[model samples]
Target: MVGWVDRANSKRAHTLAQIPHEWIDPNVINEMKERGYVNTREYLDSVLPQNEVRITALTATELIERIRTRKLTSFEVCYAFCHRAALVHQILNCCMEIFFDDALNKARELDNHLVTTGKVLGPLHGLPFSLKDQVNLPGIDTTIGYISRVGHKAVKRSLLAKVLENAGAVFFVKTTVPTAMLASETVSSLHGRTLNALNLNFSSGGSSGGEGSLIGARGSPLGVGTDIGGSIRIPAAFQGLYGLRPSHGRIPYMDVTNSYEGQELIPSVIGPMGSSIQDLELFAKLVIDSESWNYDPQLVALPWREVPHVKKDKLRFGLMVSDKLVMPHPPVLRALMETCEALRRCGHEIVEWNFPHNKRMIDVGEQVYAADFYDEVQEILETTGEPISEYMKIARENISYKGHSGRALGVSQWWEISREIRSLKEQFLEYWEKTRDLTSDGKPIDAIICPAWPSAGFRDGDVEFGCENYTVPFNVLDYSCVVLPVTQVDSAKDIPDASHSPFSTEDKKIHEYYKPEMFSGMPVCVQVVCKRLEEEKALAIAAVIEGCLANVEKL
Candidate 1:
């Protein structure tokens, strides 16, 4: 039998061979590998035809409008994205599956329907949509970067995929993910590592890194990613996109392949990633409008609600600079402070928020995430005799004891952990309620602004598991969180603080990783979090913040 590495290499070669020769640019490939970084958006602008570039840059809503007006046919929009996605695959290794022929055929059918009936198909008519490898599509294998799952085609489409397809989304490709979708970086024994489109040396941020990198590079305007612990938000933050990890019941998760399907203490939720806040809102509203609960009993029956328009002066925000577990690096700190200043100048009130028990919440969250000690992952690997990828090994180094498993807790112990999770949520709610006293308006803050991660983006395989202090707590509390890009890392302005003191060993390690030169061009984003299941309001508030920043930039 061939070794797993050889098989994995062969699989990657097959994927590369699928890209049409016309899209392959040897000069761009050599240039990207030589410089350790490449601005893909700029490179594509110079290489791709002017028409293709213009078509692919349009947002999802814009594409739908043009298709409806007969200004652009569905086939034209689909072909543009398919061509660009092929180039993205060659440069970044972000694609796991490509089916452009099928995509074009569907686009032609949509165009024929529109021309004959003179009626639009659906809200997302003719829009090119990408998916993470975990999302099941008919006649395609959702390997999700697992060598063992290779060649095992999905028998049916996942509920989310079906709904999106019904709503007129063209599925041309599925993006790469880390093995088991458990790591913060996108890599696997089967598909290899996915490089950041902005800087090849740094990570794209996973387990949804592929979606982030592709969208960031302008390959696709919209995509879907799942989050249990910051999977969606981290990738969006790293790539400077808008992502929402809605509370568990807001979106459907039926028939999705996952490592540990039984673990529901901190259940993973499906959400959307897009280039703009409007795209995010459209995705959530469309999915909710589908009434997914009818197909998946696990989903809540709540219909999409209208987002209340809160005036800038009426908005109250809590500013959390540090969680005391891991202080954000200077670039991330600057992004937070800059966002706060923009909001404050626009008449929003900002209050200091100190949440010391966030560390405890993260601890309980990890316990819930790894309750099975990765027995399921080992089982899958054993079936194909594939060695674990280096990224996954590094992610589990601190927790796993032996090669196959970690210490699994008993039922009673699991129950104890669940109770602790519930207790922490209650305590945090009380803390938020107490904030009513701190604000001048005498009400709890509408949302909190905090760092998405310690630094802008980490080098591949360098991400520590528990360092996501700001993001994981919301996941633990099942709160609605939106990641909004605020600024890019400016080396001169975001220099390290010389008088800073480390809070712990992890904090010291993170502080030492902050080299301004390494992260200079990467994006720095902040997370805006609201109470549980308040996705509509959270998205509206995020839009307000984004608008305020844009207005400030105009000055």
Candidate 2:
């Protein structure tokens, strides 16, 4: 019988072996080692062949449009992204499974179909995409970074995978997730830690860390990630990518394995992590247009709404700079302020808002997330005599940082928690509607713009570095949110508030860790959140915010 160590090493070896030696550039590897901060896409351009970089750099929309016009072949786009993914995995340890040969073959078939039938496969025809580790593909291991599940192969494709494949999307790699997919940092005893490619010393953010790092570095054009408590938004924000955290059942979660699978109170939701808001909308539209709800009864029967003007140009946005628990680092605050100013300059309304239910939300989240006391996680580790990851341990241990126990809450206990959360949801909804009175058109603010994390990206192994107070409330309410990349850390302008005192121990720990020099140039973003099941409106506002940020960059 293979022990956990051998099993883990074997899995890592298999992933590395999948990348051809020709794709490995030792010089680039050496350059990365010598440096800490790198503009990953820019660095790749200097090291990789111009044609490959050019093709890999194209967004999913551009790649498909070019392939449709015959300006580029599906084969070329697939090979380009697969190669870039290879290099990125070698550098960042983001990829867990790589199937380049299969992807290339599919790409060739797609090109031939276009030639013979003069028709593309579907909306996403010939576009290359990546997957989060838990998403199943037949014959692939969906261990999701657990050694015990290493050799077990998935016999069927996840429903989401099938939907995308049928739409002409080619998949070549599966990204990483933390143990039990619970940690904000992606580190597993099976595949090791996924580092931020932008700054090798910083965390990539998880459990979608692999998807974030790969897409952030331009290794994959678009990817799908699951979010329960900011899993999608955290990595997307840390790596400076646009991500969607849809309301439960908005996207099919059936056929995918997850922690506490039966827990539907704040069940994990899947959404897109991509280069642009358009790609997120595209992925959502394609999946929903197929009426995926028919295949997965858990899905919402919400069809894609074509709202050319979902909201007015003069929008009202609730600005949340701090959660009153963990204040953001200087760069993050700068990014939030910059975004606020940019929106205001565009004639949009900005109103400062504070959260009164965050502490309650955090406590409920802890009770729900760790209610089982990690029994499943401990059992999985014991099976192979594998030690639990340090990040996971630290995260679980910190559940009491708020002076509450996360022990198993029996059905009745959780029922009360669920009931409390639902009531809070009603109260929050009331607050949302009351904001309409604060608006010129008597409509609630289009979305709430706020910082995603305390820092741009925490240092590697800095798992206990930040609080999820800002992100947890939305998950508690099941609101649709999108991460909007605004700016990167600037050492010159972002200095610490050394004179400020801490509000709590968690605040002190997070505050003490902020160093302009350490996190310099790291990507910083703010999440744009809309009401429940309002993804179209969220994305629309997010696009506007994205545009405002772009204009800020121009200045």
Candidate 3:
């Protein structure tokens, strides 16, 4: 049998070969290579046909309305996204699989249905949807960066996939992920590395990096991503996209392939990623409205709640500048502060808040995620003898408490850890409730604004350079979190402070990584979080913050 490396190469070659010749532009490839970093939006604007540009620019909501009104056909919408996605893959290496012909055909059928019947198909009719490699689609391989699983076809589709199809959504491509889905950066033996579309020098955050890159590049309006330890939010923050990580059981996780399938200490949840808050809400409401619990036993039967509109004058927000574990880099700190100021100027109340035992929370997350001592990752690597990617090695060294040879936790120790997690959750909720005394109206804070990461986006292979204390705490607490992009990295304005002291060794390393010249032009985003199972409130608050920022820009 041929070696796994050869198999991986063949798989990549096959994906590239599938792209039509007409879509392959030699000049674009040369331009991407000649310039180490090329912004996809500007590049595509200069080259793509006017019609394709206009079609792809429409938000999911706008596109659906147009299709319903018969101003634009489904074929036109799907074709535009497919063509742009093909280009995105060529430059960003984001897609692991592409089937534009299948997508186009599906679009044509939807258009025909619209013509024959006066009724609109569904809320997502004719929308072009992207998927993370972990999500299964029929007749496609959900390799998820594993070389051994490269050629194996998925016999069935994930529940989310079926739900989208039933709602008149068209699937065309699956984005890349890290090996075993364990790393923060998207790189693997199978698909190489998916780079940031905004700047090639930095990483597209992972394990949902592919989805982040594609959507950030405006190749797709909305996509699906999963998160355990900030997987979905990390990519969204780095790529300057809006993403929501709902509480566990809110969205169905059934029939999805994962690395550590049995671990429930910190259950992974799937949610939507998109360019706008409306897109995020639209996709999430559609899925919840479908009553996913009927199809997946794992889902909670919580229907999407329509959040009552809150006046900015009455809304209170908790501002967390530092998690006390690691202070964010200058750009992230500036973004947080600016967002707070904008909210305050809009008549919102801002209260300083801090949670207890953040470091211990990180410890709990690491132990739970690595509870099996990475045996699953080892077994998958051994199946094909594929070498671990450098980023994965970095992640293992930094996060894994025991060395590579350590044993799994015993049953008694596992139970103790579980109890500790339960206690921590209760304590966190109590603290949140206590905020009522600090707020202006004697009500708990509506949401908290914090840094999504220590930096906007880090250089490739610097995976262990920053602490995810901001995003991971919510995961452990099972609270609903949304990432909202606030600003881009500005070199002149976001310069490092020489007087800031590092909190720990990890903090020192992350501080050193924050050179203004290196991260200029990257997107800076903040995390907005609410109580557990409060997705509706979290999303509305995010929308409020987004609108406030837009008004600030107008000034």
**Model 2, 1-555: lDDT tens per residue?**
888889889999998899888887656666865664366666777778899988987788888899999999999999889888888888888998999999999999999999999999998898989999999998999987789888799998899999999999999999999888988889898999898867777888888999999999999999999988889999998888899999997898889988787988888999999998889999988888889888899988988887677445588998888878888899988988999899887788887667577788878887788878787798888999989888667767776564445566687888898899998898888887778777777878778988888888788887767567778888888999999888888999999999868878879988988888888878888888899999888998988887876787788
lDDT of 3 by residue, 175-274 (tens): 9999988778899988888888788777898889999999988899899999998999999998999999999988878889898877887999999999
Clashing pairs in 2: none
TM-score, every prediction:
0.96, 0.96, 0.97
lDDT of each: 0.85, 0.86, 0.86
Which is the better candidate, 1 or 3, if ranked by TM-score? 3
Tell me how many residue pairs clash in candidate 3: 0
Write out the backbone clash pairs for model 1: none
Order of all candidates by TM-score, from best down to worst? 3, 2, 1
The TM-score measured for candidate 2 stands at 0.96
**Better model by lDDT, 1 or 2?**
2
* Residue-wise C-alpha lDDT for candidate 1, range 1-555, written one tens digit per residue: 777777788778777776777776757778755654377766776778999999988888788889999999999999999899888888888999888888999999999989999987888888999999889987788887788777788987899998899999999889999889987788777887788877777788889989988988889989999998899999998888899999999998999888688788899998999888889999999999999899898888999888566643478899999998788899988898889889987889899999879878877777776777766787788877887766555556655532325667888988898899889988999999999999897999999988888889898667563366777899899999999889899999989987889998878888988899888889888999999989998999999998889889998
Candidate 3 collision pairs: none
